[model samples]
Target chain A: MKPTTLRSFLPRPAINQRICISRVSRGYAVQAPGNPTLQVFNRNTKYLQKERAASNVERSRQADYLKDEVAMRLSERLLDINRHFNHVLDLGANSCNIARALTLPDPDIDPSKTTSPPLSTRISHLTAADSSRTLLYRDVDLPFNQEINLTRQVLDDEERLPFEAETFDAVLSSLSMHWINDLPSQLAQINHVLKPDSPFIAAMFGGDTLYELRTSLQLSDQERRGGVATHVSPLADVRDMGGLLQKAGFKMLTVDVDDIIVDFPDTFSLMRDLQAMGESNAVLGREPGGIQKDVLLANEGIYRELHGNEDGTLPATFRMIYMIGWKEGPNQAKPLPRGSGQINIKDILGGGEVK
Target chain B: MPTRISPIEKFAKAAAKCSVESSAYGKCIVVDYNSVHKDKCLTEFLRLKNCYLAAAKKP
Candidate 1:
């Protein structure tokens, strides 16, 4: 990968090694709302080298922490949504969370295999792909159908997937895929890998999810300065997500937003959680960790005034979507078309029509 | 001293065991899910490889 392309590509930080240094159109001058050009802080090369030297062990430790648990549940969920999958591929399967989810037995497993596939029935082959070598090597000793890590990005538009066309039975990406700068292009690449009847699932963070906090920050920024620059890069809406999946040659697409409301002792705890998860938005065009201590305080006040309930615990919302789509193929079931003729309410009532 | 499994090894084992259905890894994971160890089950499951606890709360 060219340095330009590699740097330009949206980063999918492995486990928790996410640190983005933002350099706007101008040099050292950064552009964020409420502040014309904030100073680039803490992310200097020296700092990074120091950080790397300091916490190289911690970086691996973080990856090691949740390997088994994530894989189990993810495997289960994948199994539930995808029936009759012979081959499965997991993208950036960090500690294999979705893979773990896929492993869980399907609730709809047929008893006695009553003219149906048995429950917790394994896929014929499983493939795990990621850019992290430490993570890639972790799976080397483990038992997988066949794990592939040498291949960097399955969605490489230039070469595409190395696997044969119509090869994979299913493809699942959880909390990843959004990191790609060219998401649509990558999605198209993924479409290529999956067999026509395969299932595609992606669980990702969406725009309206952290509305309370985002809105509060915006308001505060406006109050502090004349205008605000975009902080959080918006996610594909539910409708767009479904359309994207469908356009990627998928059918039977479903996008369900799982709104999880979390209670925090205060806003600080929520921010801490986001930090711990390495989920801080990294819009290359946007500025990093806000400047102006007073502005942050003002933002906090705004958040408290608007979103804080009487209990003093600020409500934090994460708008997440559990989406699934099926690859279009000859064997795939076609969807039924809706009748174009409008319904007649008066005729159906019969009270209005004597006949 | 007792055996102190490295967190990396621990998580790797967990992820492998979690995602595998009938794959090579599944055979190793004896999901000791029983009456007394519910939270442990949940935590262990959450910790499973690539298994995302989407709606999981801080217990």
Candidate 2:
């Protein structure tokens, strides 16, 4: 009862948040809904039809949430699965994965049932916005396009979002938000979006990803050269990421990390997947602009030598963390009426106090 | 024995976020919760989300 504080929850999302006012802005413009300046809204009518069809497919799709058995076990100890949310926001909801996995329209439950409300009935409206890799993907039906809205907009790390504070029921992100360099400020913006007692859920790759690649490059450089060698860009650690969440004011914080080994037959296959997914690291503070081929080749060689086995295929480890936190309400409350255990029925009977 | 947030209080918070300005209307009265959202109201409104998810998994 004492309005469960942040300590009671798991997977604090504030770790990945980064908010900052930008002196530099990128190519941006608003395309009118119809007469489009950009091609995103081109086939609005066609999109509506495709969206309708996609929803039919989504109704049956079982969302693949997590593969790690340990993460699944840890998550059971973390999330308050029964807590009902009203206003949910999907921050950087690429392909609408997490939203389909969670959210219910009729939160008030019948108690006997196991599943949430159906896709059509649950989740009042889910708004999924991301800077379009192609404006074409907006209506492009992939897998989980259900009753949701898509938009093309750049998220400012420092400034407040277009929406008001304490408005969303819950804000969720999966495999996104780490791109932000000013992660702390973004966490505050997430806090600003939720109403008191709301929750934020998120998942992101931890810093340990590509370590074999990083380490191999470092050792090779040390042996032949003096300086540290550049390899795969690193991710944030789970403990450091969690500290950022606490600083963002999210209570009941919890973070869980899962080590997933990814096998790549070759580097080109891995790079292609990264490009299609728009996952090339975009950290703003990197030294300079432009990529080189020789450096990349050397880096790959180093990574392979460190993590490869006799089979020749390379192994890359990806650590993913899922976090959550609550927007603290005024004055936490405790259940069972504070200290109601002091009274004794035997004392009342002996004193003849029965009415 | 406890503080139970009224259903209406909880619902209004959920409903108010979906209330947006009508694109067609002039600034006369921008907030358009009535006509624009009426048909798809259940789609974004909590009154329907619970039903869809709870039944989605059932055989």
Candidate 3:
């Protein structure tokens, strides 16, 4: 967090911006022939589509509290920037939760605590894009007129955004980036479409997400089958995301973590909730044939014993990593050139003399 | 213009270069198919990758 670190860590805006442009001159170079090694996420679009379909069905039956929470929180953070966006794109806009949050503030929800202006006032147009065809058509039931503000809902994959360069003024993604197979390259795609100095804010589950469930499942599999299988998809660590943003040619970057712990009656209900949320284990390396009955039961016991609360409910932790990065531009802040500091750190710390 | 490959395909291609004979565990890449499920995971991964490519081709 030191100034020196920031200077070294962040790419110089003006120079790096041009460099980024040249590097991505041809747009996303995803499939070079004979490369043979670019499988980042499971990239199982069938499973991904199925998961989104199931979540869409669940959304009709019950509200998605987690998605709504993330959307609202992201909205709050976007407003904190105090910049009005003429056009904003919501990537992986599952059911347009973030779009709704941006377009309309709930009437029933308390507004007394909200001091800043509503996001709707600032954004002239909003586009919600998602890979799930169902989510693209799903009813968000927004209070605002969709035609006026929520301009477009497109069904598209995040990995390859079909947009011209420097299109949007701002971009927001919630709880979706983690599923991307190649996040860095995809982030570069994001960087490509954004206008210079525009902000891109995203939130995804961190490495610590579902730690309790993962540990219990591992213990159960080990005790019952004498080996552990992949029950949870690997999550991105917060520490790693900062470097990714920088690598993607972003400036003035920030990454932080937020933890949400929900209590369930039992492991069964926890698993059900995960399914309903479209967050089931879809790792390609996962043990095939699914969890056996014995292992599942054992996992329940272990989960209850280890993470259960006094109220007979078990804890499920979700660590969300939030990141904000600005597309490099001349307007963005840049660190002073090295050896330009007037005050020496040693002088302040009462250390050695000037060299 | 050069043909633009999908990000997943690019990652899959990069993964092929790594012949560690075990899971490639990292922040960006985590392929446990070679380690745990062996050929099953790898086969399925290839099939899925092809599906992604085919799907990407349509419109």
Residue A130 in candidate 2, Cα distance off native in Å: 2.0
Best candidate according to lDDT: 3
Docking quality of model 3: it rates as: incorrect
Ranked candidates (DockQ, high to low): 3, 1, 2
lDDT of each: 0.52, 0.49, 0.70
Query: Per-candidate DockQ versus the true complex?
Result: 0.01, 0.01, 0.02
lDDT of 1 by residue, A49-113 (tens): 22232234444434332234333434545545535667777775544455444444454556877
What is the DockQ of the complex in model 3? 0.02
- The digit string of per-residue lDDT tens for model 2 on A86-133 reads 445667655454444432233344579776453323345555554332
Candidate 2 chain B: worst-modelled 10 consecutive residues by lDDT: B21-30
Task: Indicate the docking level reached by candidate 2.
Answer: incorrect
Docking class of 1: incorrect
For candidate 3, what is the recovered fraction of reference interface contacts?
0.00
Task: Give the TM-score ranking, best first.
Answer: 3, 1, 2
